[model samples]
Target: MAEARQLREYVPAEVPESAAPATIEDGDLTGGATDHTVWSCAGNLTAVRSVRARVRDFLARMGHSETVLDDAELAVSELATNALLHSRSGQSGGVMTLFIRSDGTRLRVAVADQGERAGEGGHSREDGDDFGRGKLIVDSCATRSGEYWSEATHVAWFEIEDPRPGLSLADTAL
Candidate 1:
């Protein structure tokens, strides 16, 4: 078995006040000229709803279509659920973090949990299992998925291309 990776210590830098509300406090990981939003919460079941709401609000501010918004929200929810249910982050006093970044063309979502490995010792499911279908939903909606371990945390991310390019908030008439 492969040894688990450890998470590196990070200190969030202060962004300028003029920065966009969604600006990344941490370093940019999405490699795009776009704003980013981040959230950190206790690793518990309730964090799922909080993360989903934040994702919806962020996408709305970015003028994403209703379909895209729904897809992003669902994907984030699944990621958070997995962190809370399968990772060490779900333990008491553990933490989970979420990041969202978007350029005009694509949206990326990442969730990080303080886990030794990606879904380490997670619940096993048989072929006919009704639960544990979150990954399927994520794969169906996202154009791409990525996973990596940093320090003691496992990060899982997904990206979705914009359905309607060049549509700004003014264009949406919102």
Candidate 2:
């Protein structure tokens, strides 16, 4: 993992009062809470490990053991990789940021990037397909499930159940 540079503080824009529940527009999806850690990452493959390391470290500070932190780090890596590869059809050169927050009961991670839109929902890869399985892995990581959403200049995030209750992040079913 490379060292992460401070690009800028993540300043969340407000969702309009009239915004619908569970849907966000023109703002950070702080994922229903503000007591989250924000990590700024450059929009390159190299940024993946740095962001993953940071998430695991934050979880450790929150009292998670190394074992649990490893699970979360794996999920963060996948999400960051997908964001860099699929979030845009061309260059993803701006930055990728990770927002991590947990409340003991669950842990949520949101990897945000400035790029072309990558829409919501999940898709499966046929046996021979060579690509497009990132979301499937992410879906399993979520304790409940995971989702994706996007807009013109930003794609916010998805959340999965943090590894707890004996549910390994990799053991999650698609």
Q: Judging by lDDT against the true structure, name the best candidate.
A: 1
After superposition, candidate 2 runs with Cα above 4 Å error = 1-43, 88-92, 117-129, 153-174
lDDT of 2 by residue, 72-161 (tens): 777777877876765542243345556676654356676655455357343346635556766566655554334443343333344444
Give Cα distance to truth, residue 159, candidate 1, Å. Answer: 0.2
Which residue pairs in candidate 1 have backbone atoms (N, alpha carbon, C) closer than 3 angstroms, thus clashing?
Answer: 6-151, 6-152, 7-150, 7-151, 7-152, 8-151
State candidate 1's TM-score.
0.69
Candidate 1 residue-wise lDDT, 1-174, digit = tens: 011122213212122234323423344334544433333444458879888998888777776777788888888889988887777767665667677777656788878777753445545576455667788899888877656664566777777888685465576776
Q: Give RMSD to native, each candidate.
A: 9.1, 7.9
TM-score of each: 0.69, 0.58
Off by over 4 Å in 1: 1-43, 116-120, 127-131, 165-174
Any idea how many clashes model 2 has? Answer: 3
